[model samples]
Target chain A: MTRAELLADDPLWLILIKAVVLLLIGPLMTMFMVIFERKVVAWMQHRPGPNRVGPWGLLQSIADAIKLPFKEQIIPTTADRKVYFLAPIVSVIPSFLAFSVIPFGPQVSIFGEQTVLQLVDLPVGALVILACSSLGVYGIVLAGWASGSAYPLLGGLRSAAQVISYEIAMGLSIVGVILYSHSLSTGDIVDAQRDGWYFYLLIPSFVIYLISMVGETNRAPFDLPEAESELVGGFHTEYSSMKFAMFFLAEYTNMVIVSMFATTLFLGGYMAPWPISLIGDNYLNTGWWPVLWFMGKTMLLLFVFVWLRGTLPRMRYDQFMRLGWKVLVPVSLVWIVVIAGIRAFRNEPNISTSQILVFGGVALLVLIAVAMLIPDKRARAEDEYLVPVTGGGHPVPPLDLEVPKPPKRRSLSEAKVARKPAAVPAGQSTSDTPDKESE
Target chain B: MSAVLAAAAAEVSTGEAIAFWVLGPVALAGALGMIFARNAVHSALWLVLTMLSLGVMYMVQQAPFLGFVQIIVYTGAVMMLFLFVLMLVGRDSSDSVVEVLRGQRLWATVLGIGIAGLIVGAVSRSLTDVPVENLQQQNAGGANVNNLGKSIFTEYLFPFELTSALLITAAMGAMVLGYLNRHEKGMKRTQKELVEARFRGEYERPSPLPGPGVFATANSVATPALLPDGSVAPESLSRLIDSTASETFSDEIKSVAGTEPGPDAHALTPSTKDTSTTDTKNTEDTEETR
Candidate 1:
């Protein structure tokens, strides 16, 4: 029987067990991910991470989880109390819900009943993931607005813009995968990749998805919403205790969900590697073993997430936005058109898929070269508009590239003598002398 | 997509019926809450709840593709933009008790009922006119999304293309409206102009503003800076802070004791001579304000 048919036949108690397992996976993975990320980041920087909690501070997240609820919950005086309290809950539920559609493995026998290792599989599982991630932003925006503070409000607005811009690119990237897979369901997408992964086939879409997933999860360079240096904890600036911990949990959980999602979409989901799958007539790819492979690929992506955090600095807001709208969105659009062209050509009897891909690749490269050769009008305008060395009304120092010449300094004795009216030059008034000195 | 309509037409399954019963009233309550919520932000949140429930309702109806798109487009993109604008404009930009438009509330109630009636009528007409078998025929060959795609490209092609054109126009209009002119005269002054203006004495003092609580008794913000000649420097205090030094000038001086020069005392540091000029400047400022 197909996985869906098997899933449909699950008993009430078994479904309940599946639901419970799905719920447990989010928090459990989050706990492990938190410590793992910290340890990895610490290692990258040549430092020992948390060592005091459990064996190498493994119990730290659990202790934190215990401590969070007991800590004082601070509500701002000017806060909209109802929405203020609701935001974190709103944020967390969607992150967990998104995980429900993620296929962990192929059909597995659980307590002698056959079922897919997923909580749910809708016809549009891909869109469900997108929808859930989209819904997740509301929590952030509402939290920022309800805080009744400037920083949180700014943070919320930023996140809203960030999500909206990146979501287009993200959605477009998935379209290429959906086109090849010929199905919106996550399980079907994974199944379609039996021969080869979409990541390698649709390289451009893969790269776009990789960049966008980071932006979607608010990780690393794209983490402007919670930029501590700028907005002082961004949207969660006013949240405390359990409320704050919930947001933290939601963020880490989102990280896991997106990483797993990337794995499912691009790394062949729960399928074992080529060598492992080759053994025993594809034995490792089936049942419980696939779950191990799924988790392994997910961890690899999660490590990439951590590695990015350790490597890149947080991007400037304008540059980040430009990258999303100007670079990622346009590139995704072009890539989609190219994919559509290739897909169209695949239907012709004379053309092979490989030949079409090679032709399309060459054409795209030439197009890019031509595009690059053209000078940017905006850049030329900027070059023509010379910036003044001295800061205008604002007190900005001169740009580092153009150092201003220093004013001539008088000796201390001369300065003191110049301060006296009698020692001042005959034509120069004492007031005028001070102004000259100042200039 | 027709599969969704077929599911609606068929005998109500126990699971779907249960879901409908659970979510139906929640969606109704959400709509009501959106209208009645006092705060604008709260109203937006209420609308979000309504949108979420509607998305689930679509899912429960076996149109999961439509369900997710409803969420992705409406709840995610559209309403998010709504909230983003609301946050930017003002959280409190809700309906005011004082009516700006005459009979607006009455018109709103009437128009709202009219729209609801229109919707009910339209839905009922469609249900009556369209046969379920035809919907099933449409649903025969492909998945719900594929059916949707086929219909959108073939039957609804013009409308789809029109919608895209409309969207592109809207986007272009937005771009035009938001465009910033870099070269407008008096838009931005050059650094050279600012420096020259400063040297010309057209700007305020070149020296930094004296910080609050400088050489004061309490060393708190409310305690204004004391000048070299035992006078309160008004510039040192933030307008937000209470002017405690000005109100209890003598008391504050006494509190600082001999550390501060007494008002009547003539013997003081050399800086006292320089402050005598600024002391007159302060008196002039206060007099002008008075």
Candidate 2:
């Protein structure tokens, strides 16, 4: 029987237990993720990290969990109290909800009752994750808006734009996977990858998914919305205590969700590695062992998240937007067309697999050539101004960047004279210039 | 669409009926709350509640794809853009109730009622007269999405393609409308112009403002710097911080400085006096007197 069929037969007590377990997974993952990120980042930077809390800072998240609620909750006087209180709850709920469709392992026996290790697998399970992610942005935007402050408002707007821009590319990338798997259900997609993962088959889609996922999650390198240097803690600037902790929990939980999703889609969910699968006619792929493999794959992707944070600096907002719209979106469109062409060719009995691959290669090369031939509108527009592009057609900063001149130095005698009551008029004239200039 | 609704209605479980009854009133309340909310953000949020309940209703009717798309497209993207624009322009810039166009409110009320009656009449007519098919049987193997895709591509291909073209045109129109001609607007200022303006003495303070100093009370950016004589350096406090900060410290400055200086008493800089020495001397002077 299919996984969905098995899921439908689950007893009420078993379903409740599964739901409870799924809910617990988010917080537990978040708890581990928080300390994991700090420890890994600290190791990368050659720092000791939070070792004092417990064994290699294992209990640090627990300490934080204890401390957060007791801290003072300061609601800003100007804030819309209802929305302000509602924002964090809005942020956290959908994050956990997105995890419902992420299949952990194949059908497992829980107290001798057969069930898939997932909360519920809707027919359109993949879109549920997409929907939840889309809903996630509202919390941020609302928090920023309800704060009644300029910085938070700006932060919120940036996040809205960022999520919208990246989500298109993300959805398109997922379409490639869905096309290959021929199903929108996460379980079916995983089941289809018994022989080969979609990542190897659709490299462009994989790469685009990687870039867009990072952008979608608001992680470092694309983390402009919550850029601490610019936004002063971004949307959560006004939030304090448990309210602030909720947004924190949401972010880490989102990281886990996206990582699990990427694993399920690209890395082959709950399936053992090739060598291991080969042993005893896929012995390791069966029973509870698949869960370990699934967790291992998820952790691997999570490490990539941390690795990216440790390695790359945050991108400029415009540069990030250009990457999303100009680069990723167009490439995804072309890739989708190519994939459709291949699928069409595969359906024709006369065309052999080898010949189809050759045809696909030629099509890809032709597409790349066409892409290269297209002149850049932005560059051409810049060229019209006839600004000297000194660094090989790249716009360079001005050679002689001017610095403001320093004020005329006052001697000790002049300063002493200025301090005298008689020199009050002279001091007034000197000070007046700066004040006037400032205006 | 009606076939899908008919199939869902045919099943009519007790739980499904309960959910529909509960959500119907909630959705109505949400819509009413949206109209009545004082704040624009609150209104938008209320609308979101309405949209979410509608999405849940769609799910309950065995159309998960439509439900998710409703959340993703309407509540997620469209409403977010609404909130974005509202926040960007001005959150507090609520619409004035004073009608610029006379009889606008009366006409709006009449038209709203007319539209409501028309929708109700059309829906009830369709419900009674339309032939219904079982979508559950068609989608027995959980092939609802696949079946929808097949219909869109096969039977309704031209309409689907036309809709995409319309959407692309709308996007292009938005891009064209938003495009700014920087040259025509003269919004782009060269570095040369700024530097020349500074050299021409158009600005009084050619350099950036001095950093906040080590005052006895605080050394934060909001705290104004202390000069050698313990008076506040007017240029040292950031204008942004100055406007929002409650403590101007005029009384504190008077006590610290001993004698209050004139309005423009900020010209006591000596090239020879180190800031650390001056700060220490000021502190010691205050301590000795105390």
Candidate 3:
């Protein structure tokens, strides 16, 4: 059957089943992502993770979820009650909505009806994911704001700024993928990569996307929003119980979604690996087998997330933003141009391999020459510019400690003269008179 | 007008229309409560209620994204910042109303009414001109993320980028403004210190000793005259003068005794005193001759 026929053939009941499956998969995947991230990070660090729950601590996430609602709910006195209540729901829903566009597996027969293994697909499915992720920022911003505390507000602001910054790079990074596939639909993009994954061809875009995804999801190393060492749980500082749990669930779900998206866009979604694909069509790329391939690739990316969290310390907010705007966005833009050039050349049927080689060699030469010629821009000297001391008038002397001179002391007689006279004077004694006479 | 009205009526649900009828006044009341509540915190709560009602209105209009964003951004973040600032500054509830119009309540009211009139006029004009066709189209598919994305990246790309620049500018502006306010406070403290230093430099010391002849006259007045038989008076006039002079000197010394001398100054004081005594004698002799 054609793609359209396969998509349209799903009846109402089948669609309902798909939707339920998609919805259930989100929370379940998020739970596993949480457990897997912990276990993998623990393994990397030579320690045991979540071994107490059901086998290998897999049930720990479930227990935590169950316990969440029973925990105390705290409504800050200064918080806007309605907004506080709505923020977590705002955060979690967008993540689920973004996941809805993700295609899990190939067309499968469910209840004797052939349908694609997805809740729904849009022609602009890739853009929908981006939009949903963008919308997720409102949750973090609101969560920070509704906490009605300094740290949370700062965290919210940082998250908002971080999202806005990284999102540009994230979107720009995907431009190469879109150019290569000649399609914005996630499924179409995945299908176009049947010959070769974009990760092999557009390595820079993949790297940029990988880094941006970490920042976009506010995960560790890029997790300035919830840097407990700095922001004290970041935007959701005051959120408690199920609300807090929802934020946690939203974060993990986002990680899963982004990793899944990465797999689909760059690493060929649900496609059998190189070795597995070579084995033959009978063994792999089948109904249930493709799901395993997709999950395996996505889990590898999730492991990268865990590895980053274990290895790298969280970046300062400004540093995170600088990397996004200064490094990632610029590099992604250049990479997009190069990818576009390659696509344009490839579209020419008469283009020879030598011509491609010549173009590649020239590009490499120009990159090397530019790298060699460009001067390194170091941070400006400490005294180059005076930072206007805010809130107080004097420019805050940069934190180089210079001991101040001690205050000069006055003579005792001079100090005594400065004191105000007492209201009542002591009566003069005859002894005082004789002492005065002797003086 | 009738056709447009009918179209609008068709778009709204009967249940929603009922909800609108009920909630419209309730929302207005909440807005009024926000304006009139004595406590700033209470007013913020009322504003939250107003925002919630507005969210419901958006939901009724089938714009769930806008409804949620409104609640999450404005009511959540913006209002929270307002409350945080208010709390941090410690604005007194009782004083807030009085402070709002310290000198020109009338002008404030007039300006407020004028702005309200302008908004009402603009909104009414825009409402009449809104393309009903677009509303129908928007209502059909709902405001899904895909449509929003397409519109943003394609048609509104420039505006979207501009909005991002505006946000960056705002963040930087807030940091600068906060920094400046803190700097001004520090300047004020330094100014106070300068003023105190000037006051200290202007301080003058009063003289402690009178001339030698004046002391002698004072002593003679305090002493009794010698008896004609060459016996001393029961009370000595010289003694009286000396005692009075010494008592006055001690009182003057006590009055000026509080200056804590430096260690070096304390060490040199006795030597300095001997030199000053010799100088005082020479000065006294010159003054007596003059």
Q: Which candidate ranks first by TM-score, i.e. highest?
A: 2
lDDT at A324, model 2? 96
TM-score of chain B for predicted candidate 3: 0.52
Measured over the true interface residues after superposition, the C-alpha RMSD of each candidate is: 12.1, 11.3, 17.4
lDDT of each: 0.82, 0.84, 0.73
Question: Could you give candidate 2's per-residue lDDT for residues B106-195 as a string of tens digits?
Answer: 999999999999999999999899766445765667787998899899999999999999999999999999988764545764664444
How much is B246 displaced in model 1, in angstroms?
A: 11
* Ten-residue stretch with the least lDDT total in model 2 chain B: B258-267
- Candidate 1 chain A lowest-lDDT run of ten: A384-393
Residue A239, model 1, lDDT: 95
Clashing pairs in 2: A437-B204
DockQ score of candidate 3? Answer: 0.02
When 1 and 2 are scored with lDDT, the better candidate is 2
Most accurate candidate by DockQ: 1
Predicted candidate 3 versus true structure: per-residue lDDT over A26-142, tens digit per residue = 799888887887888889989998899899898988888788989999889988776788889988987888876687788778878887776655545776677668767777877
Best by lDDT: 2
TM-score of each: 0.78, 0.80, 0.59
